[model samples]
Target chain A: MAPPTTPTLAPPDAPPPSTDLADAEPDTGRKRGLTGYLLLLPAAVWLALFFVVPFYSLAATSLYDPSGSDFRGYEMTYAFGNYVDAVQEYWTPLLRALAYGAAATLICLVLGYVLAYAIAFRAGRWKNLMLVLVIAPFFTSFLLRTLSWKLILADDGYVVDTLQFLHLLGDDGRLLATPVAVVAGLAYNFLPFMVLPLYASIDKIDPRLIEASSDLYAHPAVGFLKVTWPLSLPGVVSGTLLTFIPAAGDYINAQLLGSPNQRVIGSVIQSQFTDAGDYPSAAALSMVLMVLIVALVLVYVRRAGTEELL
Target chain B: MSAARPAARGTRPPAGRWLREHLVLVLGLLVLLYTFVPIAVVVLMSFNEGTRNVYAFQSFTLDNWANVCEDQSMCDALWVSIRIGVLATLGATLLGTLAAFALVRHDFRGRSASNLLIFLPMAAPEIVLGSSLLALFVAAGFSGQLGFWTILIAHVMFCLSFVVVTVRSRLAGMDDSLEQAAMDLYATPAQTFWRVTLPLVFPGILGAALLSFSLSFDDFIVTNLNAGTELTFPMYVWGASQRGVPMQVNVIGTVMFVLSIAVVLVGELGSRRRSRALSR
Candidate 1:
């Protein structure tokens, strides 16, 4: 779909180039008509039908009488007690999921920042190749990769053997079936999400600024803090959100790598729906999880001063 | 580059200087290697001989690769995933490309609202998205038909947001001057679009399509919730994990990894060559 353009009309004056496009106004001569709506109609309908409407359904489901089973068919009693029961029963897993997500996000930031910095400022001619390498691991299936982690952290694996040899672990200690493995899996799997955004942000920082800081006798560490770190905040915010949201919702790593003690909110939701057929509680838990994430994201975006993220 | 630095005077120890200079690069390479550790395991295990214990690598054998479809069910699941991935990619890309164009090229009321609508799906977690869709299906009485169509719908729903974001960024970054130039040359709006605008945005569309396919194929959480008895490759792998995982799973993993890397590398090389030609 193209806007009607007159051959004689001059193009609109270009705005000063800025990376942030969210707030930018449409350029002059943009079609101020029905075409936009028409173009957007199909997608809007799909999302409205599938994405937006589902939430309404979920909300209704959440309020269904908890005693109603899926096989017998749930009735919308508007009980609202499902939320109370869900929170009371599954609060531990929900909190544990958030904690694991936060821990993984923190690890990703440290590792992602270093790697992104190197790619942005130091890779030189090898920049593109390194970026490719960063994304290559994701080409593999997620479950397969997490399964590999299971093997890597297996009780009799080399990693545990080394840890035992170094006295880092007792003889009976293991990485698998532990919170550590689950968190590491989350961190590892989501590192690319962290790295790509951080790289995009860090790559745009003018090198001259860093050089000028050094020239002014700022130490390397001090310069990095003052110049590079603040400039990459947008990336950090986006990357951490990208990493944390999926990690928190993820059950695969927890299911495959951890014991029952390490079960997360996602695993509970799945089993509730599929195994227990408790639609109301499952729906309630999902709603709670979404609401919690949305609230956290709002507070986070406001605190980070990246209102454009919304 | 280092020689031009003021601090590169021959006062420091060469060994210490070298280590300090390359430290970040070394560290970055190590982290990159860490990401590949699983792929290495996957590739190695693809050649492993069968054993009751599937965690550790057994003696070297190429039988797994030779009999990649030893488990017929795994292959069936894989085919289902591929078909759904293709169809979902097409659906999401078509719809999302249109939305992206609308958001970028057209001035309209409630534009910010529409933008938020597109953004919400990406931000929402997969479990929530999956469950909500499942709720909708159950509510709509389509729960009995939950299979390929339900899985496809969920995939498209989730992937649509990403496609819109990806394509919108590309469209935003484009130099609109070329389209303006085409218009100045008396090209009709349709002509300008086909000859100038679409060509310029084609790379982004292609990228988004590839991304959509991969996302759809690799999806587990959302698909599993909606996939009533319909197993995809990831679900197969998940189920197998509870029992003993087949070595052939590694074979599929290795193939996907190699194939995608090859696609990416080829794209990179093609772009490099094009740039070289343009410069020349």
Candidate 2:
């Protein structure tokens, strides 16, 4: 409320240096170190116990014998084959999740870039109001929003009808229970993630740079490419990762808006744990997803020419 | 921050320039409209008179709004969510604010590692976090007792990272000279912190708390995994979606939407008034 809910405007990758860290003096400053450790103790301990320890448990579970049931008690036989088996069985959904996530991230970038650019450079006195509007849609429950999308894309709904009228869709073709709806839902849900970071980066660019480019012989398009796009790469990198990681792991949109045929890896992981009670298989799949994302993000951050990402 | 400056160049044709200048704004508004289409549906359908089984809006009526709690389970789930959201926010904000202060105001070894640790929870997908927490609980023999306490732990764990980031930014952006001046004016360390630091950081804490509440309240995937048989609002909606959805769900959604918007509007107006008074 104090700053109008733009708390996330700060780039996640580039954390500000601590007061002492930025100081010219190079010593650790023993008193400050003591205070720092004291203050950091509770959070550090909590994260270590719950956040860090759980990964160990998950990894251990992943290597447990796949034949063991929850009732029968799992044996940690170090069955690394669970990873191979999980991938073998669920490769299609895994690939589909990555594909869907990539498409949604790209769509979010396009739509979000337009909105963020408008708010950044063109909104005059309406800037604050527009920024608030950007976050307003997110405060509501995401499940509720996805459900509303369900209704909006219903078989007999206006969207489908309008599409048929325009001959973009066949008379019998539908938006509901389709990959389009799932991807659309993903893009809509994660659009804010994309916009906020882009706005944060784009807003910081001095307008004079763009003006200077135009003042030269450069066309407006060339000026934008030379000035705006390169300056906002940090935001683009972080925004895409923020949108893509969750989009890849989300099952809610697929579950609510798509048929069983469109199940993503998230849906598979969820069902494996909840319905099939296959903890080992679920754990294996979860680890795979986490590893794949981490590896991809590392490569992406490197190629994006930014080392700021944690 | 102001954009009232005239265009940099006046040589272009007026008509083409006007279109080019405003094109992104128009396209941006359309994108916003796309985001709001579903929220509009939620608001509209709150007045719908559809019965238990039908998904369509048949006629307009206020029955759903009037009897929002008619479905006892929905009310119960809503209460559960509210309670969890409050507790999680308080826990996360307190611990995270302390962590943020440590990171920003002081220097220590393992600082980079600590920063990465704080960032990891936010980066990981909800499904992975939820599954790993559930695994820990099961392995620790708390499998059968996975209910209120487990949900609270998971919520705090996830929310803590966000709180840290928000408060850390606010703290880092603040000027330390104000605190130094207070201390030089014969103020005790506690007095300086309470009078100078706390006021400056309070807004970040408030924002973090609000963000945490919305996140915990709207959360479905993590809460679902650790909730056991205990139901939250999102879980209620998930369960109802598979069967017949009560219109009361829409009523609650509308209420939440209205309440959050009202809060934002009031804050905006208050800030505007304050700035006006200061300028005068």
Cα lDDT of all candidates, in order?
A: 0.88, 0.87
**Clashing residue pairs in candidate 1 (N, C-alpha, C atoms within 3 angstroms):** none
- Compared to the true structure, candidate 1 yields what TM-score? 0.95
Model 1 chain A worst lDDT run, 10 consecutive residues: A12-21
Clashes of 2: 0
Please write out the lDDT profile of model 1 over residues A1-310, one tens digit for every residue. Answer: 4556454342532432122344436554456678988999999999999999999999999998888876788877998888998999999999999999999999999999999988987788788899999988987899999999989999999999999999999999999999999999999999999999999999999988987886787877899999999999999999999999999999999999888777899999999988888899999999999999989988998999987655
Tens-digit per-residue lDDT, A1-310, candidate 2:
0111111222222347532233323333222447778888898888888889998999999999999987889999999999999999999999899998999999999999999999999888899899999999999889989999998899988889999999999999999889999999999999999999999999999998988887786899999899999999989999999999999999999889988887899989988988888999999999999999999999999999887555
Candidate 2, residue B210: Cα displacement in angstroms equals 0.3
* Candidate whose TM-score is highest: 1
lDDT of 2 at A272: 90
lDDT of 2 by residue, B28-82 (tens): 9899888889899889888999856455778999999888899899999999999
* Residue B119 of model 2, lDDT score: 89
Q: Show where candidate 2 strays beyond 4 Å.
A: A1-15, A18-31, B1-8, B273-280
* Tens digit per residue, CA lDDT, model 1, B9-86: 354566776776689888988999999999999999988898434767778998888887888999999999999999
